[model samples]
Target: MRIGIAGWFGSDNLGDEILLHTLVSCVRSVDESASFVVFSPNPDRVAALHRVDAERMPTLRARGAVGRQGTAQRAIRDCDILFLGPGTVFQERSPNLPWPGTLPLFARIVGMARLARTPVAPVGVGVREGGTPAGRRLLRVIGAASVAIGVRDQRSGSYFGARAQVIGDVAYALPIPDTQPAAAVEEAAGSARPTFALSMRPLAPDTEAGLLLSIGGCLDRLQADGWTGDFLPMAFGQDAQGEDDRDIYRRAFGNVLGLAGNPLNDREGTTLAGALDGWLTALAGYRLVIGTRLHAAVMAVALGVPTVAIAYERKVHDAFVDLGLGRFVVGPDVDAETLHRTATAAAGSPAEFREAAGRVARQGRIAREFVTATLKGLG
Candidate 1:
């Protein structure tokens, strides 16, 4: 059997790559004979970065409908099954980025699969807030896909109608090497020096630029409270000069707190596994996490660190709420004083925080089983 996978990939971001690897690996575990045709923005880059032996399927530039039916049609025709899995596809958080013509892309791919007698599925997918008219239209079309649909959030599951199943984020199910000792994780948290981690993406093209100013101000307050700032950029899109944001935050710390530079730029790291391993290990000492990326915050939970989620959209809020800790989430426009107060309160309960982390670890194991079983059922 052959499988075709689609979504945001080939970027330097370790989180997206890990989710892709986990979904692909789970599918293959159930059917070892299956091979993959991955639809990626840049095939050669993805191949080199992940070392994945997948057939390179082209996608359009990050603009609206530029090459919609071009490469996806071909991939759909050739595969036994095609999947549009996880990523920020359903959310238009960055106004600068173009929205995919969802109806056309889905129709063409699903039509091709129908003509070729192939099955289609949407797995580990979630639809967050869609503010624009085009965005909401795309959400409706994605909801109507006549294939197996597994949504990560309760909101996205409701959007998918009757056939949809509510599962946790796919990254929760992704495998990590057992390198870090449990005792080491506990000891680091107990050190209690008030370490804070932040992972954020740039706002959409249409978003107000001053949003960055707000974030900078919040980080500055964090510094005054004697918090050490750690920054992780999840997906480095086309922007090269974006490290300035980190610099601004680091300077806000007034030299007392140190900054660990971009984890992706580390020369020694090659594979997604290596990058994530290095990044998580480096942050093992964090006491509080202020993360924008869903998986970055999930990584903190996986490593027994308590997190404060900067909820830019629904999925961010939903993920933490489902984990039994909504108090850690705050709005995108949150003020510096609010951020400082929230972090201070969150950091005080280290013991309870550790227990919550344990729950996430257990849930992660169950999430892995869900994906494995779903793949077997598909086969």
Candidate 2:
């Protein structure tokens, strides 16, 4: 069987890359002999990293649409189905980045699938309110073309009508690694100072600094109580889009936190496998997670570390609530007092967080079944 998978790939976002990894892994388990062709912005990187044939995805602008049609059609025509998303590819500028899903590639997915007469399967995709009429229309138009649709959270399901199933985040389907994480804030056993991991993005410009300061102040107070904090970088080259998570950390909390290095940006460049190992290890070492990145918070809970989330986006807020951690997510405004309060509660409730992780695993099992069954049905 041949499948064509597409999303915001090779964009240096590890969270998005994890989705690609888990997506391909899930599809392989469903059909071991299945071959894949991916369309990405960085075709070579995606091809090498995922070990699949990849074509540079076409630009969304009208000027170059025709020149790129052949590549899109070739990839689509060869596949039985075109898989789109497991990312926040359908959100509006309200949460920032005004494009209609991955630089308005939603239109491209529909156009190519239609031209090739291939079924489009949009699995574990996220959706949010669109500020503009055109943005709202693009979502409806693309969603109408999908053969089977799966959204990542409840709020997104509301946008796609009854056919959309809340299949959970595809990243949750990733297998738990057995490797011991790298030495982080203190990976040693029985450490006196407990440490927390933090991740942030260049969220809404108006409120980003305030949110950072609030969280930073909370961390300072916690450190005074013999607690420690570490900055974990989830994306490496997103600096072009001003979305690099590390840049904000350096600018906002550099005084309080230390740069823990990402594998991609390390002085000695590392392979994707090595980077993921170090990333997971650093996460596993933390006593708690206090961050805005949904995946980081999700992973912390998955690793049995209690996490307090700052819900900068609706998707993050909704996902945590669905996992029985609603009380653990703070506001976009994120006052220090509220963050400290939630962090305290989360740190004290390891068992509760473990149970939350179990709930995620349960959802992940269903999502995997959904992927396998969907692929089998297509075949």
Model 2 lDDT tens row, 312-338: 777788888889998899887978887
Candidate 2: regions farther than 4 A off? 60-65, 94-96, 99-104, 131-138, 179-190, 266-271
Candidate 1 structure quality by residue, lDDT tens digits, 1-379: 6678777676656667777877776776677777777777666556666555454333343554446455556656777677777665455543444454343444455566667666666677776465566755555555565456777776777655777776677777655545454346546557534567777665543332444555667777777766656666566552323423344444443353455644456445366555666666766557777777777787777666767888766778887888877888887778767876777777775665667666676765655666565555665
- Colliding pairs, model 2: 93-96, 181-281
Off by over 4 Å in 1: 53-74, 91-94, 98-103, 131-145, 176-194, 204-225, 238-263, 266-269, 362-367
The Cα error of candidate 1 at residue 30, in Å, is 2.7
For model 1 the TM-score comes to: 0.80
TM-score of each: 0.80, 0.91
What value of lDDT does candidate 1 attain over all alpha carbons?
Answer: 0.64
Best by TM-score: 2
lDDT score for residue 164 of model 1: 76
For lDDT, the strongest prediction is 2
